[model samples]
Target chain A: MPLSIVYYAKEFFRGEWARKFLAAKTAPLVTPTYFRNYPELTGKTCTHHLFCMMACPAPGAIDVVRTPEGWMPRIHVGHCIRCGLCVEACPNGVLRSGRILESMFYDNTKLSFSFRIDVDTERCMGCGNCAVACPVNKLIDSQMSHGGRASTDDLLLKVNEGKCQVLHVEKCTGCKTCEHHCPNEAIHVARLLEAVHAPEDEL
Target chain B: MTVLQSLKNFVRSKSIHVAYVDVGSCNGCDIEVLACLAPRYDIEQYGIFVHNNPREADVLLVIGAYTPGWEGKLEGLWEKIPDPKVAIAIGNCPISGCLFNRPHTLVDPPVAKHIPIAAQVPGCPPRPTEILSAILSVAPTVFKDYEVRK
Candidate 1:
């Protein structure tokens, strides 16, 4: 054991490993460029097209606010899903992140599905059963916890003035719970599957 | 203030022990954390070590939405960690409950109500780099001035 220790000490003192050791210690692994980094503003100015805001799936993720230098899109880091949809939605070269835009042009296809709730007012009796069954409604509005008759303005949908009103359609998870609970069949939740593609696709 | 004490403190700060807890998360954040430990992210390069035990940990990683199943017991879990410890809430679940915050669900979000959070990394499940940065920036502050306090 002592002889082995002496041999290792001699090799260490010879200093072949010192340079490699220093280099390894000084440098660390970097996040890959293809990684979906947060969106950053480029030299191209924002035109307030509001396309980025529409494309963002996460609520409050992207907002076109009037900054001191005019209208610009502000990305809320805490809420952003980093899905890169906002980067693709910008008409001008205002925002860029990773290779999300390049992926759209290549054979890589992006698929997005959205839910649209169509309520037929003619057949509606305003029972609020769908609202009571809605998972989002019961979670957001504590008043709905007991029954759906509560008048809170935060619910996804509620009975107001003898008719069912959809408050926040964006909050729907497309669970179809509301559609299943509606006895009158007035509320119909339709799933819209759309393919994401480049705006100016030649082929 | 002695030389030996300062050296010990420096050595201790250089080596950080991290223990993670999942109160009620969907394991998305846990997957990201696993990536952090992977060779590409390599959190250990910063001298951060991860294990499941909380007693020896200097940093506690809390991931997940506050679920009903963990109710009345999360506070007890918080007490297990030794002092000079920092809790980093990873992903949006713990930050705001994210998608799990919705109806018919048993999630009680904003995990800060139960445990004190030193930092937060927000996303559906944040990138591994974000988790690495969160631990690197926050852990040292709690261990700062170790000998002086003693």
Candidate 2:
């Protein structure tokens, strides 16, 4: 059938039903007898926000729904507000906050900065302090920085070992304490055992 | 009076015609207003329909904040619209004088300052649902059961 024909037929029937339904349902929602005296308010307050979400079928997109049991509120990670309030409110330590920033150039160049806890392959004794301290699941060992493909010997950390003042093994725990606190911003603590990686080339 | 009742009367009588004008907006609000014509937001579900000529239109849906140069044009357009007609200021820029509100900027701060606005819809490119609510609020015949979403 032609699009306009389909539209007119569907719209005509829908309009009749909607008008009848609205006349009944909208009466209590608006002031009675007031419209007879003032018609402008009819134009001024006509709105449809309350019923719009009922049409959305996307799961986890909306936090609240008007179900047969009445309005129901659901919490899902995909629906996160990014406010960090839920993370702080969780009693079982199930939520953890993570941040990622990416800068893209029209020429297809990419620059990104991400912060995550990982082992310092050269010095790590695998004590797993950071993993245990994490609020989320203790999958700290799985939190590889580059990717878990490279071994400790294959990974590289650009460090001036000769200029480094702290040389003693007893003083260095290899737990990334110095890398975390380094003011010069030159030290890059790496997990050599993990995979060495680079950003994928863009098309 | 309840806007809903007046709206139903208007729809039953088939009385109002609306005109849309684009000023200095980023076109986001314009798109939302357009969505009202679609199946979901369906503004035409009521008797309201868009008019090409300002003189015939019962309501002027002004989208975007007016620019300084466009002030005279807007005034002229308002004069062209027939009396008893409502002027609706849609979007945050025209209502609250948002990002386009810089004093030295070329655009006028807000449409309300330049014209006798009948209603204002405030939003940073408000959702179409909100736009529909605002439209129906000003011209009840624009929609039947108007629900303003946050």
Candidate 3:
């Protein structure tokens, strides 16, 4: 049987567990994770130029996964050699090495943390520079009402009135595209680390 | 508290000997770490000493991100440290690879990936004051945990 058929049969018979189990066996020697100390922001500022994805030496190390909100970049730790190329390739400084784990159990959701996107309402002209730069145009356009005519030259972005609002918080991937493209520095994206439940006695 | 327990605490608290290592860094953090022991910072007044040998060290201060070539050396040094040791990553490089998180020279994961990290002080090159305070804050918790395990 072809590999595609084999994969399909496995998925149909065993469901997601077969793949998850396979992922666990090949876990990285050392896990290098990233986190944003700040919490109020959303979505990475990634412009979707995919620079980091290209620079990554490992195949399938960096990929875009579809969330309910939209497509977001995902890091597969099992294949990662702990090379920092993807981090350096990012111009927005969105990715930073955070925790180093001696071992890691397979968890797809735990591979990358989520981000929150916050707009600086005061500084934002609602020019849609972020919208233009965003890889998922439909997600941005669907959320915000277009007030002004779209500009051909992104150099001078103008919004007649009202500002872009992130309708969905969990949808953000923290790619840092909007944060980098904003002329007035209006957008900020931050990662949200899972809160550790400290023991009551420790607290 | 039992007399033996109190005595152990007293002796442990009286002095904190540190071993400093730089894996792959600009040595900016190394200078700042050393400055803490200099007369200007005078950490010795608080019974802190930079012993430079891991066998005598109660605390291991790692100053750089672990490079590909130095993994064995780092592991060897880590093993040489006596038990009840506290490892504090001194700067951003050792904890997060800092600005050198690139692939050209094989600067991959931070030090924590190799050894267990007790605490971390973050900054490209953290201030001497920050390094001093991180050491002070992390030492007690590590010692306490060690005592509990014992």
Candidate 4:
């Protein structure tokens, strides 16, 4: 017992174990390079083959929606698991994520995505399809007094001043419910991919 | 409130004990809950502890659709948690059954039909941060009024 104790003590104090212990304590910890990140748009044209949607394991995580630019895959962040399967499944290089797809992108702490609503003033007939179909707007203005009309200004978007105005862009969750409800396809919700921390003033 | 009572309120509001249940989900929401427990989110930093027993839970996180197997079992589980308990629906499944409560699926439409839900974190399976914020926002108000209840 004494011999074993001496050997263990020496190993703990001066052997490889001590070096390992110190290294472990001082090593800079970082997320694995291969760790899956949220899939992002690559600006490549989407064939809309629905491979990404089929491969996504999380429910309501990915969907192919029609935009004026054609069919594009929309990632619902709330439901996304970041499995990277959708990234692997895309036939075209449209959706990108994971170390396999890593390129000379911004090396930053956060890579977030935000959706911005773009109203085609020329195409928008002020029909209020998007305004009426927005779930948050409905919740905020439940008493939508008139048919397809905002009863109050406390809404995410409204058909005010004879045009659909986005009152609060921050309220957009990228669910794209409004995009689907648009009959003339006037309202466009596009995912704004941010690879690095934007300036506070710009935000 | 007395000093002791106020102190209790402070502690109770800051801390929460959550019990998780998976009625019949595809395990997607449960995985997200697991992510909340992991160090990246570290819900313990906010004084949130997760366990399996509803008896010790201040908040009940309901996942998945109300499956047929949990028809009466879910209610029994809810009754196990003491009063001043807040039930949080942690996914779109529990809120509206997402893709489960189809035309004639063997699941209930919404969990609220069986239990009183205090909050609904609506996502197919919500992000861990979203779940954390939901719990942090709801647990305090629900437990603050505990000691004062007649």
DockQ values of all predictions: 0.31, 0.05, 0.01, 0.05
TM-score (C-alpha, index-matched) for candidate 1: 0.68
Q: Which structure is stronger by DockQ: 1 or 2?
A: 1
lDDT: worst 10-residue window of model 4 chain A:
A103-112
The C-alpha lDDT values of all candidates are: 0.79, 0.49, 0.64, 0.76
Ranking by lDDT: 1, 4, 3, 2
Q: What DockQ number belongs to candidate 3? A: 0.01
Evaluation by TM-score, superior candidate among 3 and 4: 4
Estimate the overall C-alpha local distance difference test score of candidate 4.
0.76
Could you tell which candidate, 1 or 3, scores higher by DockQ? 1
Comparing 1 with 2 on TM-score, the higher-scoring candidate is 1
Lowest lDDT sum, 10 consecutive residues, model 4 chain B, at: B141-150
lDDT of 4 by residue, B89-123 (tens): 98878776776655656888588899999998876
Candidate 2 to truth, TM: 0.41
* Docking outcome class, model 4: incorrect
The sequence of per-residue lDDT tens digits that candidate 3 reaches over residues B1-150 is: 455675676668557888998888889889888787777667776667888999999899987878888878888999999887878887777766765776575886578888888888875466677787777787666556345434
Query: Which 10-residue window of candidate 1 chain B scores lowest in summed lDDT?
Result: B141-150
Q: Give the alpha carbon lDDT tens digit for every residue of B11-34 in model 1.
A: 787788999989888899999999
Give the better candidate number (2 or 4) by DockQ.
4
lDDT digits (tens) for residues A80-165 of candidate 4:
66767677666576887767454322332233446699998888888787888888887888776433566676788888766788
Query: Which residues of candidate 1, in runs, are more than 4 Å off?
Result: A1-7, A14-27, A43-49, A106-193, A196-203, B39-46, B103-105, B147-150
Which stretches of model 3 miss by more than 4 angstroms? A1-203, B103-105, B145-150
Clashes of each: 2, 29, 15, 0
